[model samples]
Target: MKILITGANGQLGQEVSRLIPDASRPGRNEMDMADPGAVGRTLDEIQPDLIFNCAAMTDVDGCEKDRNSAYMINSVSPSVIAQYCIKTGARVVHFSTDYVFDGTRGMYTEEDAPDPVNYYGLSKILGDFAVIPLSNSLIIRTSGVFGEKMNFPLFVYTSLRDGKEINAIESSYSPVNAANLARASVEVERKGLSGILNIAGDRISRYEMALGIARFFGMDESLVRKGNKIPGGIARRPFDSSLDISRATKLLDWDFHSLESNISRLDVH
Candidate 1:
């Protein structure tokens, strides 16, 4: 199958590229998602059978500071891609975040109404809505994704490696391994699934997740401090944005990797 992956530099995008080695992986230089014309032209040139869009303005505080860029990348760009795909008969698999929910409730089902608390969440929700009407398009809502790239777990590991004290938030989330998420994405496409689905690991708090990482890397857990209050940032984060993966688990017949297992699987230091 002719497949194209955008944001190939990102953790999830890199994992997807690894899984689909033959697929066309385009960097920002080749296909800048921020430019709608460039995205459309790229789609026209590749004419891929499937497209995986992993690009987004993911930095919450960054989004808060620059709402224009946030909406442009997170919402408008995907919508542009979706429109092009609809015209060309290409299927799309887009990645979204748990931030779409306000975190007032945990284990959010796909059917749950989204009430985003921050600009980042609002931007992603707009993206979700943008592509929902398109045929053969799927939006996977995940949380706390970690992989070889700089993420929560990797940050914790790096801080410990430097012998620096790290403060982890008490906020809870369902952390999905990027590799597992990539695998699930392919599975969902193969099964010809459409619409929204939640693909996430078991829910765990930030502190416990850090502790697990410490144990996995044989690091000093004492260096990891528990942060009771929300970390200072321009944006407000949801307290509990864990997603219920029952649908994905049953549909894909795959069990997502636990935090410890995910950590052990990583080859990076």
Candidate 2:
């Protein structure tokens, strides 16, 4: 099958690229998601039967500072891609986040309403809505995705391994392995699952997650400190953006991973 994976350099994108080695993996220069026209042209050229839209301006604080760029890349261009998928009868899997919820309560189901607390979440919500109308498109809402790139787990692992101190926040989230998330996405897409699905690992606090990383990496867990809030951040982070993956769990036949299991499977060099 002709496949296309955008945001090839990102954490989830990197994992997806590794799984689908022969897929067309494009960097921003090849198809800048911020530019809808460019994305449309590139999609036309590739004519992919399956597309993984993993591209997004994910930095919550950064998205707050630059709302225009966030909306353009996160939602507007995705709308264009969805339109193309509808026209070409292609399948698409767009990744969303747990931040779409206000975080007032935890264990959010797919049927829950989205009350985004920040611009980043609002932007992703728009992207999710854009793809919802497409019959062949699927939206996967995940949380705290981590990989070898610049992510929460990697940061914790490096800091502890280097004997550097870490003041992790107490915010709760469901940390998912990007590799495993990619695999799960493929499974659901193959199963003809459409609409929204939550695919994430066990829910845990950021500080506890840091300690787990230290233990998994054989580092001093004492080096990690618990912090209350992000230092001087523009965006307001949801205290608990944990998603309920019950649907995905059943669809995946209880193959969902937990924090400890995902850490055990880490293949860092």
Candidate 3:
């Protein structure tokens, strides 16, 4: 099957590329998502049966500062891709975030209404709406993504390597990894599951997650400082952004692991 993946250099995109059976990944240099004409032309050339989009403007603070740029990347680009999928009858698999919901509830379901709190969330929510009309579109809303080349663990590693104190929010929740998320997306797409699905790690606090990561790296857990989103600076993060994965598990016959388990599975070389 011919497949096209955007954001070929990102963590999830790279994982997807690794899994694809002789895949074709066109970087931004070949096909800039920001340019609608380039995206359309590339899609027309590839004529792929499946289009997996892992690209987005995910920096929450940056989104808050430039809402227009966020919308252009998160919404406009995906909308253009969805239009191509509709025209070409290609199955589109798109990745979204738990930020789409306001985190007012404990566990968000697929049926829950999205009331995004931040500009990044709002922009992704817009993309979710943009592709819903396509019957072949699969929307996977995940959270707390961490993996190779990702901002989360990479930033933490940098802090630790620099011997600087690392402050992570202990109150927020989410247990997702980009590698596992990419694998899950491939399974769902292979099975032709179309609709909104919450794909995330088992719900857990950031404090416990830190301990797990510290254990994995054999580092001192004391180096990890705990902080709260409210008292701390930046946007208000969802205190309980855990997503209910019952639908994804039952329908896809898939099981997602915890952040610790995902880390354990990684080869440390």
- Which of the numbered candidates is closest to the native, going by highest lDDT? 2
Q: For model 2, how does the per-residue alpha-carbon lDDT over 134-250 read when each residue is reduced to its tens digit?
A: 987899999988876667787777777789999999888898888889889888888998998899998898999999888877899889898976667789888888888888887
lDDT of 1 by residue, 1-269 (tens): 78999888788998999988999987787788777778888888888989899898889999999999898889988998889877888889999899999998789999999999999999999999989998789998999888777788778878888898889888889997888889988888888999999988888989999888888888899998998899788899999999898888788764674676567655464
The TM-scores, one per candidate, come to: 0.94, 0.94, 0.89
CA error at residue 174 for candidate 3, angstroms: 2.1
lDDT string, candidate 3, 45-114, tens digits: 8898888898888778888888888888888888888999888788889988889888877578888998
**Global lDDT for candidate 2?**
0.88
Where's the lowest-lDDT run of ten residues in candidate 1? 260-269
Which window of 10 residues has the lowest lDDT sum in candidate 3?
260-269
